[model samples]
Target: MKVRDSFSLNPVGNTSKYTDFINYIDTSSVNAGLLSEVSFLEDEFPSRAQRLVRPGDILYSSVRPNLRHYYLYNDSYEHAVASTGFVLLRNNSSYNTRFAFYYLSTNEVVKYLSNIAELSQSTFPSFSSKDIGKIDLPDIDRKAQDQIVSILSAYDNLIEVNNKRIKVLEQMAENLYKEWFVRFRFPGHEKADFENGIPKGWAYRRADEVIDFNPTLKTGNQTEFTIIPMEALSTNSMVLDSGCFVRQDSISGRRSQNGDTLLAKITPCLENGKTGFVMGMPENEVLGGSTEFVVMRSKALTPHYVYCIARSYYFRQTAILSMNGADGRQRVDEDKLKSTKILQPEKTVLDHFETIVTPIFDGVYQMVQENKNLIQQRDLLLPRLMSGKLEV
Candidate 1:
């Protein structure tokens, strides 16, 4: 059976089910199976928010299929809408929906669709829902489909659990930062001296004075270095995805090392919170990344402090406001970003904060590495099972 016969494409138009507000999902907010939350009032929805997603549907990006911007819509939001950039699929046949999701999400399927998109006339790689609908589906029994889902979901469930733990660890660190810095309730707060409404020895200064933005690095005589693409940075997480090694003479971009924070300066990416805390790299090894990244290193504070500040809402909003250029291509002005005011806590306090949060960040990194392994294991099994090379 073909996908068109197995599922309904872009099923919408139930005006009666419409509500006052909606949870909107765009292609950029999804990667792999993870999704970032975005909401809007019904009247304020974006032009592309045309697909009304159901509970058991799959949302697949039509543009740049190679990026694997897809999600299984099981969110509890009552009035959820997705951008038209996605090809919504609602299963209506006997085939298991989860199985179909995994099948369509295989690297093989993505590469095939990507090839078709690249060969098209569109300026950007893109394809139509019709292209997805014509792909053949395996004629497997429901039991076999359920077995495949069972095996695959085991890996997914473990990954989901680790993700939750990583999120909690991040929150613990961020909350600690808020308690000590934002609320001015650090250790010995009751006895702390105050100057200019801030704890004594703590003063506000330009970000550039305390944090170095796009700090210079010497990469002379290096033959190869690790390269991180913009997509490797997660909008919802501080951990960076593993990047591959490339020759130093080939691609040109920013240079960074361990303990540096890479923040995306581009429009939607900056707004989407695409920031990464550089870690787990080899000692004394410098890395290369997209020029769109602003490499931040500590000049007067701890690396942990710089990372927490970059993750803070105040810093992010300031960066957002500093963006300049064309609508879709706007970038944060490094000068403006450098000029933003930031608090400089006492040296002892900064040291204490780092000592407390280092293990938390380390734990998060370990979990991220584990998830990478799990994903690799699952990906290795996916194509084999889908192609019937490996039996359930």
Candidate 2:
């Protein structure tokens, strides 16, 4: 059956003007089957904001359908306004909302929508509300639908839990970095003598002196390597997303290896903290990523220390100030980055700092890898259950 027969598209229009602040959801805020963030619409774009979403409504992106950015609204987001780029799907009495969400998020359904967008011939391909309504869906028994949702939601719940734990662990590590390095309160600090606003042996060195920025790696066409796209780097985390495979000739971007740090040098991404520590790659394997990345590898410092420095608030501010270009296309000045001053502690103290934080970072890496595995398992199970190939 067509989706329109089972669901209503953008059914609720704004009846009253929102006098106060409004919870706004944009295309960038939604990922595939997930709502990562929201923006506030205050006295601007009033007409552009019209769709009123309620609990159980699904907001699916209409433009760039290949992105598959969609979200299932709940009570927490009640009365929120979504941009016109979304087609809100509210289930009718004939079908289950949760079941529809899973079906629409399937690989097959997304591919169909992507094909439809391509056929539109627009510069930026998109599908209309009517086009989305015409997409096909299965008519399954309600009882069976609930079972399928239950099965899929279990994995999602566990993933959420892991994500929370990952956040806590990351906070713990960041706090430690600040306490010991930024605050100069490392263990036995009272015994160390301070001279000229720095410890006895510590020195402020230019970033390029201690770190290699965007170094080249040699690889041939036959060599297979992981390609890390800018989208693969999450704004909220330091771990790179599971990357795609490509031959050496196809790789065109900043090259990095395990233990290197990647910083997005672009405007919004730089401000959003799109930094990652390259990990989980095979030993000696070189990975290529978006050219927008400023790949920082350690020379005189430990990799962990270099990563912490790159992710530090001070570094981000300096990078942001160094950015230059047109509005949205602004990029960080690589020379400025290379010339940025970084504090370096004594060798023994640096080693001690590494000893303290290595285990914490290791734990975070494990959790990230585990989440990737969980997502893979959930994706694998989704299509089978949705198609009734495996009974709920």
Candidate 3:
């Protein structure tokens, strides 16, 4: 049925209203994107004008519906204030947030909201309380709500934990970069000079000086192509697909090579950490990706160092600062990439660094790939689990 029909069906009878009514704007403030932890609303909106989050408020993101980001609020965030974008539905202080949260949470609801989400045609998607609360849901009391929420939240928390682990590994790579390159206090630092903080023996060099930059061979015309596209990327790794393929745009204009660094030049994607080394390109006719990827030559710069630098805070900052464009279609310059400065270590030193960090990035990328598998498994299980086709 059409999503509009879901609201009118009045599938839920608890008779909840738009969030604005009970959403007490707290004098307290929370920064919207600040929270990186597992708890919902860890990073909520920043408002000196505070709003209260009672233990039972259901949290939803008005923007970026793609995240499908919805959560049941709990006493853990009792005094927290959410951004205006989120609405807090307090179930008459009697209904459990978890119970209502489960019934309210549905793939159907997300699909319905996404169809009508608000966004500048060029930007991310958004929704409103009228759009939200009006969606269909199963009505139930706090106790049963507790059981459903308990199960879901437990799984959600596990996902959050894995996310945190990924973050820690990311941090470790950064710290290692700083220690060996910035501090210049490596195993051989003592024999090296202390020129300008870098080890005295270490020489400053440009990437162009260290590595040969090979632009990939461009695929021609409007010919059809299949690809294990670089949809998910990191400095060290990327996720490839076999079944999914699309027409090659200028961004998708090039043939991927064994050691290419697939840097997403487009905004949001560039910022979303889509830049990564392309070691996963399948050797076959079912292949070709965007011109957004420029092959990085590791002739002098080892692929490992190339991956590390691309993913470091330094390169990310540079890339972010260099972005330009209007509307939601902002992008970084492919030309500007060559102009970025790079630090080059001695060949042997780079090799050693590669030896140590190669496995680290490999493991991290493997984990990400593993998490991708877990996501598929969990999603496959969702219908069965929720519909009782499969018992937890």
Candidate 4:
């Protein structure tokens, strides 16, 4: 059956004039199977904020359909307005909304939409709301659909819980770094002496003194290395996406090994805090990623310590200030980054700090790996269930 037979497209339209502070959703705010963030629209762009969205509606990106940016709206986003870039799918009496959402999120539907989009004559590939409505969907029984949704949602729910735990763990590490290093409130602060606002033995040194910036790139076509693109690095997550493997010769980006930190050096991405520590890549396997990254390895500090320092608000602010180039194409100045000052604590104190935060970061890495596995499992089961190859 056609999707239109089971769902209505954007059932509500924003026609009221008195409504203020419209909740808005854009393509970038939506991740695959997740709604990461939303923007609230005021009176500034009245015309662009006319597509009213309601609870249970699926907002699927019509433009750049291959990215598969879609989300199921809930009470949190009730009465929101989304950009026209989305094809809102509102479930009807014939199908369950959760089932419709999961079906749309399937790889099969994404591939279908992507093929339809590529066939378009427009310079930027896209499909219309009518086009979306025409796509055929399985007319599964509602009970079976409910069973499928329940099974899949269980994995997603666990992943979400792990993500929250990871966030708190990361924050705890960052906060500890701030308290000890930034605020000079280390364990022995009462007995420690200070000279000119510096700890008695601690010294201000250039970042290069402790961190190696963009070390030598390994070259060869013989080995298969994991390639991490800019999109694979989520802002502030400090975890690299499970990247694809390619022959070394095909890669033209910065090279890194496990334990190195990656920072997006380009505009917007840098501003968005695209920084992560390289973890869980096969042991001893060389990793290559976007050339726009400044790969930093710690020589004197612990890897976790370096990651926290790089992701610190002060460091990011300084890096942003040092960026130079034309608008939208600006990049961080490597020289400026190397010259940035770093606070070096006594070896014992550094050891204590590392001891305290290492397990926290280790837990974060473990959670990231678990989430990746969960996503893989869910994706693998998706097609089988959707096609009835596996009974729910």
Candidate 5:
């Protein structure tokens, strides 16, 4: 069906309202739950040129349309503002909102959007609202559309639930670590033999004694800045969504290597507990960082224990407090990171710990790998399910 016939396409903004401004939701606003978390939000443009996205409105991204970021708003997400660039369809009374959503999500429509978009010189090329308006849509009976949407929605529900469960499992691990390691409470707390109540020969020692410092890096040898971009930096999970290719050849300072802890040294990430053990690096001698992470090493310290502790609230608070500089992007200085005290366990205890912790990491690692597989399956099914070709 010709799109102009059944559901007319309308640009989100109106030219008549002299004072109308674009209401682009910022990332902060999205995080605040003011708009659909799935929606692509821009900053609020305060001009009469804006449009108030009502409930049931479908907002499609005008630029980089292939990112497939769009949303069909529910009543709960109504009254938020959006950019004039989003293509808003005024569906006929015969249309099902959910069906229309799935229909628009199809690769068929996306290809149309990409094909007509001016790619001569632009970001991920995209179409203007006019282009979308002029495009044809496959017309199916409304009942059929409803049935299709219900099936696809069921898949969406499963994906969402699995993602949520992954989060809960990680949180559970974190809580357990804190209760046992941080709070120093175990099952045999009351009547157990005690060394100053540190749990039977378990001694508290400074982080310095266990680890004086990491091996010094020669980050200055590079001719241009090189780094593992943040996209390659995964948070709370093992797999990263971004690629590890570097854009630069040389850097002013040294970077990390395989087996090093790729800790995000900057704020928010450091605060958010962003860290991963570097396993595969493109080169052995590339220097780069976001200036937000402090790479730490445990020469004798088990990597698992190190990683586990680094994720704790105790370590994050200590690292954040130990950080220097007045700028928002504060960092834990090399000296401080090396000098900070830590609760050290004996090698005998740690040797015992390695056995127990290895299994836990193995379990966590298995779950992470499973999550990655699940995500891949979901992503692969998304376009197929949405397009109706795979039929749910």
Candidate 6:
């Protein structure tokens, strides 16, 4: 059967009530089923934010379908609208909505739509709802669809659980940093000498004095190295992707290693918290990343400590304030970022803090690796299950 036979394409959801604010989801706010942003806007909403989304609706970006910028909207937002760039699919058939979502997300179907989008007359690669409506999908019974969804949903559930654990672990480390460094409540605080608002041995120093900003690294005669693009960095997490490798002769970006912290210097990205702690790479792998990253390596402080500071609100706000250029293209100035002042904790306190948080950071990375494996297993089974080659 065709998609249009089973789903109501871009059905207008009820937006009957008046509200002072809206939760807006832009096309760029979603990626591969991950809903990264839901802007709570009280003033002037974007002109494109016109498509209202109801619970259980599928939001698929009309532009660049291959990037898989899609989401299954399941939140309880009373007044939420999506950018007009999406084709909202609401199931009206006997088939399960989740089953239809999985079918649409398969690589084969995505590539098929992407080809049509590329050949279209639009200014950019994009397709209309008619393109989606014309595609063929199996007319499976509700029981069969439920079985397929059950198998796929198991993997997704595990991923969600791990994500929650990762968030908790990150919060633990951040809280520790604040308690020890920011609040000056480290071990034996009562006995510590205070002078001029700081402990006797501690002093506020320029960031560059303690951390190496965009420090040079030597990639010894390697023919190729891993390349991590800006999108691979998570705005809310410290774990980074195991980037794909590219030949050394072709191109290169900012050089970093497993222990470095990558801070996005660009406007919206930096403002959105695109900072990552590089980890889970092979031993001594010299990694290359987006030119927009300010690669930070610790010189006088622990690596974990520096990473926490990079994630800190104070440090990010400082970097955001130092940004220059036009509105969308603004970037943090390296010189100004390096000159920003940060508290320099005493050596004993720094070492003790690291000792406490090292396991927390390690645990986060372990869960990240686990999630990668889960995704790979799910992708391998997706096509087989969708095609009925592997019986449910």
What's the lDDT of the predicted structure labeled candidate 4? 0.81
Q: lDDT per residue, candidate 2, 1-392, as tens digits? A: 88898888879686366766788887766777766566665666546577787888899998887777888887475358888789988888668888888888888888888888888987788988898788777878889988898988898888778778888888888888898889899888999999888889999999999998998887644367678878766666776656333445456788899899989999888887788888877888778888887899999999999988988999999999999999999999999999999999999989998888888888888887887788889999999998789986
Task: Give the Å shift of residue 86 in candidate 4.
Answer: 3.0
Q: Candidate 2: where are CA atoms >4 Å away?
A: 12-24, 39-53, 75-81, 92-94, 220-222, 243-249
Model 4: per-residue Cα lDDT over 1-392, one tens digit each: 88889888867664475266777776666777666556655667546565678788888988878777888877566457887778888877668887778888887778888888888988878887888898777778879988999999999899989988988998898889999999999998999999989789999889999999988855554356668778777675776655323445455678888889999899988987788888776666677778998999998887888898889888898899999999999999989989999888888999999889888878988898888899999989988998999996
Writing each residue's lDDT as its tens digit, candidate 3 over 1-392 gives 22233222112222122223223232111111112322223333334213355555555666655445455555363244544555455554454545445544456555666777754363666766666666544444446556655665666566557656767776676678788877776777777766676655467665567655555455545365544344434322243332234554333455555555566677656665666555444453334666554556575677767766776777777777877889667777645666677887777887788788777766656765665565555455544544655544
Q: What is the lDDT of residue 134 in candidate 3?
A: 66
Instruction: Find the 10 residues in a row with the least total lDDT in model 2.
Output: 241-250
Q: Residue 84 deviation, candidate 4, in Å?
A: 4.0
Candidates 3 and 4: which is better by lDDT? 4
Instruction: Give the clash count for each candidate.
Output: 0, 0, 20, 0, 23, 0
Higher TM-score: candidate 2 or 6?
6
Q: Pick the candidate with the highest lDDT.
A: 1
lDDT of 5 by residue, 1-392 (tens): 66656565663444333333333442212210113222323443345225566667776766656545566655443335655556666666676767766666666777777666656265647677777667655566777677766765665566456556655655665666566666666454456575764667666556656642444776545566556655355556543333343667665333666545666667656665567655434565655655455565666577666766777666667777877777876777556655655666556656665666555555545554565565466546656755557762
| Alpha carbon lDDT at 46, candidate 6 | 76
Off by over 4 Å in 3: 1-57, 62-94, 99-105, 117-127, 140-143, 193-201, 211-214, 217-299, 311-337, 388-392
**Every candidate's lDDT:** 0.87, 0.83, 0.54, 0.81, 0.58, 0.86
Prediction 3 TM-score vs. true: 0.64
Decide which is better by TM-score, 2 or 5.
2
Ranking by lDDT: 1, 6, 2, 4, 5, 3
Superior by TM-score: candidate 3 or candidate 5: 3
